[model samples]
Target: MGRQRTKPAPTPPTTTRGRRTRDGLILAGREILEQRGWSAFTPEAVAQTAGVSYGTFYTYFESRDDLLHHVVRSVAGEMLAASLVSPDGVDDPYARLVESNRLYLRAWDRASKVLRLVDQGAAADEALRQIVHEIRDFYVGRATKGLRRLQDAGLANPDLDPRLTALALGSMVEQVAHARSAMEEPYDEDTVVDHLSRLWASAIGLQGAPDEGWAARARATAGTASD
Candidate 1:
């Protein structure tokens, strides 16, 4: 009797080569968004940049929108993760808030082009809009929790609605960071951080608290600017 034929093993959905190819495509897509803006970004361009066939690009991303969504999620996830790292010796709630905002601004500055593309894409696409809102809500949620803790500790304003205040402050920082990054005239990073920290502290009723570190840095920055 002839030996029965053996069935071959099924191919894995995520092999090493597949992951490399997928990551290359994401990196290429980010580059395209940075150099050409969202309007000019296309699957073909991403494939060319990634040095992969157009078919390979489709094997990973269904469409440009899908690719954009992935890219936004990737960068935003990294930013959020980085922002979660507590600064050394920073026990004050206000200081922690300032540090988190500083980390976020730095992250936004690093990925400003991709973020801008995401912002632009959200205007016309429902999927992108959802992604944008998801990112915003993630930050706002964290802010809300932090504010609630502060209020419970009798630090933040008792009358302020934590959720609404979080949303408003988060929006203010997001818009200001985006605008400052887009400005032709370079803004002082120290000054922006100092002022924003002070504003947030004041809004949360922590204005009179000792923020000596921030004050010292701001003073040094002013002295340097004046010299």
Candidate 2:
């Protein structure tokens, strides 16, 4: 019978020198993750890139997964923080959508390579998949909160589901973020943001005529008169 051995708890960075070394590892991890993706994103690679020994890698992170988690979290935070779609913000629904989409697009553009790698890497690895799903859930949850505000304020269509609307709209923006450059004629930031925001607004009846509104009423009236 034998006892299993585990790595000791990592020491927290307290001094300036310690913090600089830790920060360097994190930066190297992010660059490696973006450049080479899952298979090549190793703690050894990070430590080497950071100009530290393999033993030093473990002083800050518990495992390769931990380092990747920090890198992904950092990227996601930057992406979300750029958007101003707080439920408490005073911006009108349409304006909020526009600003959020605009900033989100810009941030996503900056990290598109890593995001695209995340998409691909997640498909191949279970751990990476979990990270991707978690990030998406957080983004969708925030979006749903914003939509709830619109619904409560009588700005959104009564019949639309806020959570589902957020998921769909957020997915639309994600697709736009990933595929805009692939289009035959790539659109500028303002045009793309405006169109996507308009679509989001129209989806919840925020900026578009409702299906049961005057337009539908007019069509029904014309049909009845003709009959």
Candidate 3:
């Protein structure tokens, strides 16, 4: 099976007044998601934020979950655009890997709050968990395709399964970035990008794979894993 395009966001009302009201509700929902997260995101709260009657929210959206479907996908579209890199332009495999990681990390950092919310909320909330799964599948699908392309061109490791490798590496970077989002202290962006790029490039048998100091990445494993 191949990847499918993401469905477009729910269209706003065609009339000027209707459009304004619908757009207002979406903005309110987005503000809540970005500021307070899923726990505080109620249909009533959204209506209040948008200065509309509670029933009016329903007129614009079928339910809270329905509104969330639109709002989250809208935000996800921005993240997707931010992370996009033109593979055709980069001739050097290492440079392409580094650029890809850099763009992804940047986009992830911007949505750290929403990412954390989705990750932590997924366990208890099935409806909310779909947001996390959708995001994951979208990224993984693109990455798997990219990996297969590299392998076909003999630029990546032919020994590994592309989908499995995509899942593993995707999880690796996402987990690290999720953890970093929790810290108050700022990290060295350039250093993190270069380090992560090496891990992906090295794993895929891309040229200039790191030869040493790679296994020493477990520096915090003993202490961190216990927590």
Candidate 4:
């Protein structure tokens, strides 16, 4: 007669301390991306920087590239979040655009090292490049929607093409943000905002652009309570 086989007990779930350790490793890798740039990154360095065992690091992530990917994606998400939210809310669309631009400038100031690494890596890595493009595309779509709103409110030129203009403006802002990182002396916050704001204003120039009256009207209508 054959003996009945017994199933082994399931492996125990990971502990809170273990999860915290893994998160610490990821955080360490992110700090390297910010401070040392991707060129100097290594998993061993991350483990040392994190003060975690190498085996522990591997338990959460497969390799250095995996860690890099996670770091880049995280930083990209942070930038996107800042870029998407309007500090002034919906009261003033122009102010909202200006505020969001300033936010991007500030975010890039802190994230420049990571941004540069992603920019460089994207050229050689298809997945990285796609991620970069996806980030930019998100900004472009938002700008396009804003431009469309401006047009609807008679704040932008009705004849102007929103899609092309949005892409061009978004590209200009992103390039300027990246270029700011390369400067030996960082430009003042107001300087960046004024420069970008003016560039956008001129691009849609007042003859065909929204005047103060249009903005006032929009605000007035927008502020009125719904019946």
Best by lDDT: 3
Question: Candidate 2 vs candidate 3: which has greater lDDT?
Answer: 3
Candidate 1 has what TM-score? 0.81
**Tens-digit lDDT string for candidate 4 (1-227):** 11222334223229988767766777898897777876667777898899976555666676677677777787888888866664447656566667888888888877778778888888888878888888888888888887888888876778888889989988898788877777654777798887787678667642342343566787788889543
TM-score of 2: 0.76
- How many clashes in each structure? 0, 0, 0, 0
Among all windows of ten consecutive residues in candidate 4, which has the lowest summed lDDT?
Answer: 1-10
- lDDT tens digits, residue span 1-227, model 2: 11222669787899999989988998898888777866788877898899998878888888886677677777777776766456676455566677788878888876776667667768877877887888788888988987888788887877888789889989988888778743534788998987888777777878432332656789999999999
lDDT of 3: 0.78
Model 1 CA deviation exceeding 4 Å by range: 1-12, 87-89, 207-227
Q: For each candidate, what is the lDDT?
A: 0.78, 0.77, 0.78, 0.74
Models 1 onward score TM values of 0.81, 0.76, 0.76, 0.78
Tell me, what's the RMSD of every candidate? 9.4, 5.6, 9.8, 11.3
Candidate 3: which pairs clash?
Answer: none
Candidate 4 root-mean-square deviation in Å: 11.3
- Write model 1 residue lDDT over 26-133, tens digit each, in one string: 888888888887766788889899999876776777677778887888787877786674646488676676677788888888878877777776888897788788
Model 4 alpha-carbon miss at residue 7, Å: 23
The numbered model that scores best in TM-score is: 1
lDDT of 3 by residue, 1-227 (tens): 11222444445588999988987998898899888877788888998999998767767776676787677666777788999887576867677778888888889988787667666767987766877788888889988998898889887789999989999999998877776777753667798888788888888877455643445557567557888
